[model samples]
Target chain A: EDQVTQSPEALRLQEGESSSLNCSYTVSGLRGLFWYRQDPGKGPEFLFTLYSAGEEKEKERLKATLTKKESFLHITAPKPEDSATYLCAVQAYHSGGGADGLTFGKGTHLIIQP
Target chain B: GAGVSQTPSNKVTEKGKYVELRCDPISGHTALYWYRQSLGQGPEFLIYFQGTGAADDSGLPNDRFFAVRPEGSVSTLKIQRTERGDSAVYLCASSLDSNNEQFFGPGTRLTVL
Candidate 1:
């Protein structure tokens, strides 16, 4: 079965602290890996999409990197506003026009204390 | 451009009642998706619609949960005999295409009492 797991279910970091969140997956055929940031009572906001190993993407203070079996989201000098649940999802390649539904991890609840 | 939108930001209903959650995708988006997120858990896939057709409904939990996108832009998720277990946030997303990045809505919080 295809599954995605994120480590450090919860993390508390001080303002200006830099850290990384991990997402590991075991899927039949990996099509893409996605990163999202979700605030409480809101839907997830898209961050990045990594399609292959060694791929990297960045926006603002957040960066996402991908490997064969895992992906990492690195936050540089995170601020209190950046605090939210970071989610990782995978798209599996199937015979039926590529499955669009994403299998998401439980997500990492991040708190940046000021 | 405006992102996806969902109606009834919060819905509190009694068990055994029926409810409908609506989603309006971005203009020109051909693919729309529905997901459910329970407390402390990630969003789980529920259904996907490509244009006017439902490309995938395998993620739907059971027959009681149904979705429709008759016009390919606006969609509705209907639930019958709602149970307490059905209490969760219903999220709607849309993409230009099935394989592209999806834009999500604010989500509708459904609470079954």
Candidate 2:
């Protein structure tokens, strides 16, 4: 079974503080790794998709880096509005050889205070 | 373009009752997925469809949870004999194909009393 684990279950940071959230995973054959941002009572919003080791993607103040066994979501100079839960998911190549559903972690609750 | 949309933003049901949640995927999207997210947790995969047929249903918890995507567009998830343990936010997502990014809907918050 594919599994994902995220660290710092809950994090609190002041505005402009930068930090990185961690996501570790173990899959039979990784097809894709994704990062999403979710707010209270809202669905997750897509962030980045890293396909291989050493791959990275950036959007605004968030940068996602991928390794063979884990992925990292780095937030730089975050603002109050950046507060949200960060989710990590992985899709593995299945017997069908097509796209399969994702296996997600518990997520990291990030609170950015102004 | 409009993202995925789910109906009945919230649903309240009693144990042993049946409920149905709907999802309308993005136009031209051929792949749709269903997930469940409990309190303080990330979304858990339930099922996914490719076109009008279910491509995978391994993540479904049991036979009580079933979904259908007919006409290759709109989909509905049906729950039978709902239980308190079934209470969670049901999320729907869509993608262009097998190797594309999935866009998620706002989700339907289900409360089984």
Per-model C-alpha lDDT, please? Answer: 0.93, 0.95
| Winner by lDDT | 2
Each candidate structure's TM-score, on Cα atoms with residue i matched to residue i, is 0.98, 0.98
Interface RMSD of 1: 0.9
Model 2's DockQ?
Answer: 0.89
Worst 10 residues of 2 chain B by lDDT: B95-104
lDDT of 2 at B2: 89
Model 2 backbone overlap count: 0
For this target, which candidate reaches the highest TM-score against the unseen true structure?
Answer: 2
**lDDT per residue, candidate 2, B9-111, as tens digits?**
9999999999999999999999999999999888999999999999999989999999999899999999999999999999999999878888899999999
| Model 2 lDDT tens row, A1-114 | 899999999999999999999999999899999999998988899999999999999999999999999999999999999999999999988688897899999999999999
* Clashing residue pairs in candidate 1 (N, C-alpha, C atoms within 3 angstroms): none
Candidate 1 lDDT, B1-113, residue by residue in tens: 78899999999999999999999999999989999999999999999899999988989999999999998889999999999999999999998888898889999999999
How high is the TM-score of chain A in each model? 0.96, 0.98
Off by over 4 Å in 1: none
